[model samples]
Target: MENILIPLMDNELSPRFDLAPEVLIISITRETSAMGTLSERVINFETPSAEAMYRLVMAENIQTIICAGMEKEVYEFLKRKGIKVLDNVCGPVDPILEAYLAGHLSSGQNYF
Candidate 1:
C-alpha cells in the first residue's frame, strides 16, 4: 500500500470544507494506490523541517507528499531517506492532485 501526504492551505476550500493551515490530508486505497483520493484524510499539527518531516513519515510510514513548496533542507532530507516529495503545487489542491493521480501532472526534476 502507498500513502500520500498533502499539505494544504485554508482558502483552497470555498467555505464548504474550511480547513486549518499547516495540515496534511492523507489518501490511500487497496488497489492502484490512491494517494490523493478522498478516502482518507489525516491532518498534521505543524510544518516540520526536512529531518523532522522524515521522522513524521517514518512514524506514519508515508511514502509520498504533495505540497506547494518546501525548504531545500527538507528536500535533501527526504531524498536521502528515499521519501518522494512533490512540491511547487498550486492552490485548490484536490484538482491538481487528481490530475497527478490521473497521470497528467509530474512532480518535475526540481525536487530531486
Candidate 2:
C-alpha cells in the first residue's frame, strides 16, 4: 500500500505546492488491479502553510507527492525524509490520479 498526496486548486493540480488551498490523499493497494484498491481523503486548509502541509504528510505517512511546482528546499526536505516528490505535474486531479494508479504518471508530466 502507498499513500499519495496531491495539492489542489480549483479541481486541478495546484500551480505551486506551497500555495495550495487543499489537498487530496489517496491510499492505494497495488496488489489488486490497475485501478487498485483506493481509499481517499480530502483536507482543506484554513490557511496555506508549508509547515502545516509537511506536518500532515508526516502524520498521514505519505509516500508520494504529486505536485505542479515546488521550491528546491521543500523538495529536498521531503526527499531527505524519504518521500517521493513528483514535481511539475499539470492537469485535472482525477486524470492525474488515474494516471498515477495506472503507473503512467511521472514528474514533469502534463495532461493539459
Candidate 3:
C-alpha cells in the first residue's frame, strides 16, 4: 500500500501548499492492474503552516504528495526525505485522485 497526501482548499487542490487549511491522506493498494483505496482521512489545521504540515507528513509516513504549488524549500525538504512530490497539479480532489490512481496525473496539468 502507498500512502498519499493532497493539500486541499474546499473541494479542489489548494493553489498554495503552505496556505492550505486541510489535507487529505489516502492509502491505496495496487494489485495486478487494479488499484483500490484502503483508507482515507482529512486533517484540518487551525492555521496553515508548512512546518506543521511537514510534521504531519512525517508522522503519517506519507510516501507521496499531490499538490498544486509549494515553495522551493518545502519541495526540497520532501525530496530530501525521499518522498514523491507531484507539484503544480490543479483539479477537484476526486478526479485528481482518480487520475493519480490511473497513472495519468502529471505536474503542471490543470484539470479545472
Give one digit per residue, the lDDT tens place, for model 1 in 1-112: 5677665556242111112344465555554454332456646545334445455567877788766666677678777888777666556766765676676765531221
TM-scores for every candidate against the unseen true structure:
0.67, 0.93, 0.93
Best candidate (score: lDDT) = 2
Between prediction 2 and prediction 3, the one with superior lDDT is 2
RMSD of each: 6.6, 1.4, 1.3
Give the poorly placed runs of model 1, Cα more than 4 Å off: 11-20, 32-38, 44-54, 108-112
Which pairs of residues clash in candidate 3, taking residues 3 or more apart in a chain or in different chains? none
Error of 2 at 96 (Å): 0.9
| Residue 92 lDDT, candidate 2, scale 0-100 | 98
Q: How accurate is candidate 3 locally (lDDT)?
A: 0.91
Pick out the ten consecutive residues of candidate 3 with the lowest summed lDDT.
29-38
For candidate 1, report its TM-score: 0.67
lDDT at residue 87 of model 3 (Cα atoms): 98
For model 2, the stretches where C-alpha displacement exceeds 4 angstroms are 31-35
